[model samples]
Each structure stands twice: as structure tokens, then as C-alpha cells.
Target: MAIISLEYYSEVLGMNREVKVIYPEQNKVENFTGKEIPVLYLLHGMSGNENSWINRSGIDRLIRKTNLAIVMPSTDLGFYINTTYGMNYFDAIALELPKVIHNFFPNLSTKREKNFIAGLSMGGYGAFRLALGTNTFSYAASLSGVLTFNGMEEHFDDNPAYWGGLFGTMENFKGSENEILPLAARFEGERPKLYAWCGKQDLLYSGNEYVANELKKMNYDLTYETADGIHEWYYWTRKIETVFEWLPINYIKEERAF
Candidate 1:
């Protein structure tokens, strides 16, 4: 597996940006086939760089076992939001970044089943926010995520004005407890598969379970699990490996093809 770091300008955030990419190198791997590999947009928590996944989580190797393209973009302090006064980081990610990647790489499929999103901490929140709000992504996951309302206070404590701007009001955060599932009613997607898990020992456990329980009540197909762990990269790397297994990557079927 070879990792590529891309730097460029983006219209969504309206500034210079960089993203770290992990993919099987067609030049080195015979089976690489130079096809458009599936994409998994992994996000970072607040105050993190695109390098977080590789630098902290060590994802380059584990995913080499699968035919997935991992792209990690850097958003300094934006909290992955389209704020009233802050950069529209979410739009840049959910819309612009995918287009950019698809244009530069071989696209295996544009179907929702081929796309995925996952992250941790603030990125976890953004992951579900996009996976639920947008139709493009099919599979989504969050590790040690802030799964439910940590309350407007903690949300604001990070970026008071930004949170207030996108949501409009703290009240808007209320019904969101019902919105964390990756599936939306009458989903505009292929009814994308959902994956959300957090460490039982993490402080976010309560919130994660809150969203998971709510998803159960909604009759949504959710893969929500709590395990013994903590909120750190030590666990994220391993968790990501499991997430790849949970996703329906065709490589497995092809390997077991009768």
C-alpha cells in the first residue's frame, strides 16, 4: 500500500486545503487493476489534520486488504460545519471533496453502496450528520463518537457561534437525537447500511447508546455496539478494521465465489 498526500484549493471552504489518501498502488500490486476503488472519507476530531488517520490510526495497511480508497481531509478548527460566520467545511467535504476525488481517480461506481464515511469525536458527529443528511454515502461509522446530544453547552463550548449558526437554535438540537441513524425515513439513498460503535468506557457512551436506542425505536437497520475501550487512537485503528469487515466490500464475495 502506498499513501498519497494531495494539496489544493477548494471552493467549499474557500481556502487552501490538503488531504491524505491511502490506496493500493496499481504500479506495485498486480490486482490493483487501476479501477475506481470504493471511497471511505474518514474525518478527524476538532483541531486535527488530515494526517490524523495515518499518523494516529495507522489505517494504510489494514485497508490494503480491501479495495477501498481512504481519503482524509484537513480542516483546521472548522468543526466540519457550514457556520453562519465560519467556513462551510461540511459542504466542502460531503460535496466538493468527493467530486475532486472522483475526477482524479478511476470511479468503480457512483452508487451509494460504494461510498462510506467514518470518524471520531467531532468528526464522528459530522460523519453521521452527513451520512444521514446526504444520500450519496451508503455505509457510515463513528468511533468513540459524540453519538447524542452532549447538550448545547458542550457543543457551544467548542464553537458557540458556529453551532448556533448552522442549527439556528439550541432547540434544533433536540430533535437531532432522533436523527443520528445513518438511515433516513424514505431514504433518498439505497437505504445505506449504518455502523456506529463506541467504547463502553468512553465518556460518550451514554450519548452513543442514546442514539443507538433511538435508532432501534425507529426500526432502522443499525449496527450499534459497545465494547470495552476508551476514546483514543489506540482503539480507533482496530475499530476501523472491524468496520471494514462490517461493510459489504465485494472483495470478500469474490474470494469466496463458488
Candidate 2:
């Protein structure tokens, strides 16, 4: 596998941002039938940047056998939302990043069926949000994601400025813009196949259950999993392998004229 660090100015964010991409290497004897490769928009947790998955979960090693390219973009503490106080992280993720990625890596497919997203903690919410809100990804997974903003606010409401800045007032967050359930419900027509996995011992376990059950109840194609674990890199690392198995990835094989 090959890893590339990308630094470019994003008009959406109005600043230069960094992105990490992992491209699977092909054999010298084997060649791709087409230029495009399947892509996964991998996201990071609140405290992590673009290197979170590569450094913590060793994601490159996990997907080394697959024909998938992983696009990891840093959103800082924006919660993957267009903040009331600052830049449009949501547009950066759901929109601009793809254009920049496609412009750079034309071999990466832009098709919805070939596209996917997954993230942990805050990124978990982002994966779902981007997938549902934009209809760009056919599949999405959340690992120990903050699915319920209200529940999180209830427990960690001490920092009003922190949450308020990203989501605006509490009433605003209740709308379809920030909440997962509302976003999923308001989305018309076909929805992305959703997968959610949370450790039973995780603090956000119930929130995952809440959103997962709501998706299931809405007749959504959702795969929900839970086990004896906690919210940590260890669990995310293990669960991510399962996510790879669940993804609808297509490998190209063709005879090349040498």
C-alpha cells in the first residue's frame, strides 16, 4: 500500500487543509481493468486529526489486500458541521474534499456504489451525516459514534460555548441539521446502507442503540453490532476489520497486453 499526504487550499474552509490517503498497491503482473478504485472517506474522532486511523488503528495494514483507497481528512473539533463561529467543515467534508480528491486521484471512483464512509466518536456522527445528508456514499459505519447530541449534551453540558459554537443553540441542534435521527428521517428516497458498532461498556453505547434502532424502525438497511468492550482504539481497530468485510467492494481483474 502507498500513503500520500495532501496539502491544499480549500475554498470551502478558506484555508489550507491536510488529508491522508492510502492507496492499495497492485502487483506488477496484474493490472487494473479501469483506472478508478473504490474509495472510503474515513473520518477521525474529536481529539484526532487525519493521522488518527493510520497511527492508531493501522488502517493501511488492514486494507492492504483490498482494492480500496482511503481518504482521511482532518476536521479538527468542528464535529463535521458548518460551525456558527467559524469555517464550513461540513461542506469541506461532504463536498469540496471529493472534488479535490478526484482532481488529484482520478483513478479513484466517484460512483455512489463505490464510495463509502466510516468514522469513530465524532467522526462516527460525521460518517452518518455526510452519507445521509449528501447521498454520496452507498454505505456508512459508525464506531463508538456520538449519535445522540442531546444525550451527550445532557452529560457533558458544562462547556456551553464548545457545543454552542459548532451547533449553535440547543434548539438548532434539535433540527435535521445536527441530529442523526432527524437527518435520517428527513432524507427522501433511498438511504445509504448503515452499520453501527459500539462497545457495550462504551459511554455512548445507548446513543448508538438509540439511533440504530430508529434507523431499523424506519425500514433502513442498518447492521447494528455490540460486544463486551469499551470506547477505545482497540475496539475500533477490531471493529473496522468487520466494517471492511461489510463494505461492498469490487476488485477488478483483467488480462493486460504486456
Top candidate when judged by lDDT against the true structure: 2
Instruction: List TM-score per model, in order.
Output: 0.85, 0.93
Off by over 4 Å in 1: 27-30, 150-169, 176-189, 250-258
In candidate 1, what are the lDDT values of residues 26-140, reduced to their tens digit? Answer: 6544466566577888989877889888877657756555677788886666656665566787788878988887766655456677788888888887787778778888888
| Candidate 2 residue lDDT tens string, 1-258 | 789999999998889999999987876213544467889999999889999999987777676667889999999999898888877999998999999999999999999889999999999999998988888999999999999865566533677788788887677778756788888889976789999999999999888888888899999999999998998998998788888889986433332221
Q: Give candidate 2 regions above 4 Å deviation.
A: 28-31, 250-258
Candidate-wise lDDT, in order = 0.73, 0.86
Q: On a 0 to 100 scale, what is the lDDT of residue 110 in model 2?
A: 90
Distance from true location, Cα of 165 in model 2, Å? 0.2
Error of 2 at 73 (Å): 0.3
Give the Cα-based TM-score of candidate 1 against the true structure. 0.85
At residue 246, give the lDDT of candidate 1: 86
